[model samples]
Target: MKTTKILLAGMTALLLASCGTHKTLMEQKPAPGDTPRPAADSTSHKLSYVQHISDKALYQKNVVSNLTFTVNNGRKDITVPGILRMRKDEVVRLQLLIPILRSEIGRIEFTKDYVLFIDRIHKQYVKAGYNDVAFLRDNGISFYTLQALFWNQLFIPRQQRVSEADMSQFSVDTHRLEVDGSAKIVLRDGKMTYKWVIPALWDQIAHTAVSYTSPTHGTSELSWFYEDFRPFGSKQFPASQSVEIHTPAIGQRPAKTLKASFELDGFSDAGDWEPFTTPSDKYKKVSVEEILGKLMNF
Candidate 1:
């Protein structure tokens, strides 16, 4: 009986050890400060600092915003301000306030399938299919123009790989952290040729600055300022942001300066952001020249 009891006690201890080991493994969470995936990986895009920044320090509560932007088309200078009202599931109402011909231009809307532009002054509208918005062929990738659309498919974590700094030409530092189940990335890079600062604070770009040498542009540089961070529902970012891109206009003695600011001053529940839809009856078949004149308001 004594020998049998010893074997039973040993078996019971072994079983308990196995159970404890399983429980520990189940409780394990992803470690903080893990690096974002590489840039070449299609499933791991979006460089962030979620591994470095502390979430408890950056949770913004109850904030909405308006964005004001300035654009210099070389021939004319303009300021455009946009407002975003947030809703559940990251849906939002984006309103663009444009200043044109010394007047406040009407709002433009963007939906999943189309781009809508409305001329409040002329009571006319311009509609472009998502496919027609491309200036070139359907390459499936756009560097800048697509910046207008901040889609989760385009900017979300793990959607694409993050680019690495060429340490031979530049130095880099990155930090990441997790907060509220989201990732954040902060990066800084510099070299003898140029310098840039990207603060992926709380997975949102807090600020960015870039400078480089150009033979024609003559050492062009741009700086982006982000502030007034507010949270709309679950989304959080700057309520107002500004960008300045400067270059030397050929005839202008000093470099011409282009400054743009976007502010999300106010937002409301606009339901779904349907791209502006233009009615077919509003457009009449006309000659190319006539269409050009109409577009130019001639």
Candidate 2:
């Protein structure tokens, strides 16, 4: 039971850490005499760059991968073997297994309608809508935001997906190319700011950072880094990824930060498994707050 709680708590930390805000961590300004000249000095050039980046989204209908999931939530670090499965616009599921034995221990599933979390060892679960999750509700994060991060694509908040017309909302900067041969794309929506770093030579997104500020709750940030590109379909996919979140203190809660890293052995587009899971009667359902309280106290 103790081990089960710790594992679940670690997973919760990762989920919560995925949706937050931070001050810009990377410098967006070009260094003196180091700015890379734009491909052309016209609006069409900027639009072309945005179109190129937007086109990088993988068109696969299903993706599956074997991964090593690691999380550090201030107190301790836990690493385990996991499986990640995703079906475009349908669901994203992650199953964590017991090492060596490879028995299922826990799983978290995000669908278009709700989020489901299961603890196989305890036969317990939590199912809630996006609004029912405090962190997600307060931060304006939804299923699509997570989907964008996991799929490594550009996104506009409160939208199901980014469209060709929406691409205009994002501004591309070539100044950073001189610094690291990467272009920076930025978008601002209300209090939230998003930035993506992409290598100039390729259209793939290498890093993403989202920051939010609130006069009442302070500021928080979520940073996702991607590496180790491998061929997938007609495009390249990142096999190594890491997420870092820093959230400001709210009420009695002190400011907190957590990091979750995922290293995938490889990628697959097979879709043999079911996309949804229905918990049997043997499993007990719990409230989101109940789970969040337990994880926060951990």
Per-prediction TM-score:
0.42, 0.90
Which regions of candidate 1 deviate over 4 angstroms? 1-82, 85-104, 109-116, 123-171, 174-204, 210-222, 250-255, 266-270, 279-298
Question: Can you tell me which runs of candidate 2 are displaced by over 4 Å?
Answer: 1-4, 20-41, 177-181, 200-202
Residue 220 lDDT, candidate 1, scale 0-100: 46
What is the per-residue lDDT of model 1 for residues 139-205, given as tens digits with 9 covering 90 to 100?
2322222232221111211112222331122223323222223332222222102222223222344
Candidate 1: global Cα-lDDT?
0.35
TM-score of 1: 0.42
Worst 10 residues of 1 by lDDT: 17-26
Q: Candidate 1: how many backbone clashes?
A: 34
How would you encode candidate 2's per-residue C-alpha lDDT over 24-46 as one tens digit per residue? Answer: 33322222233233463456777
Instruction: Find the number of clashing residue pairs for candidate 2.
Output: 4
Q: Top TM-score: which candidate number?
A: 2
Predictions in order: lDDT? 0.35, 0.80
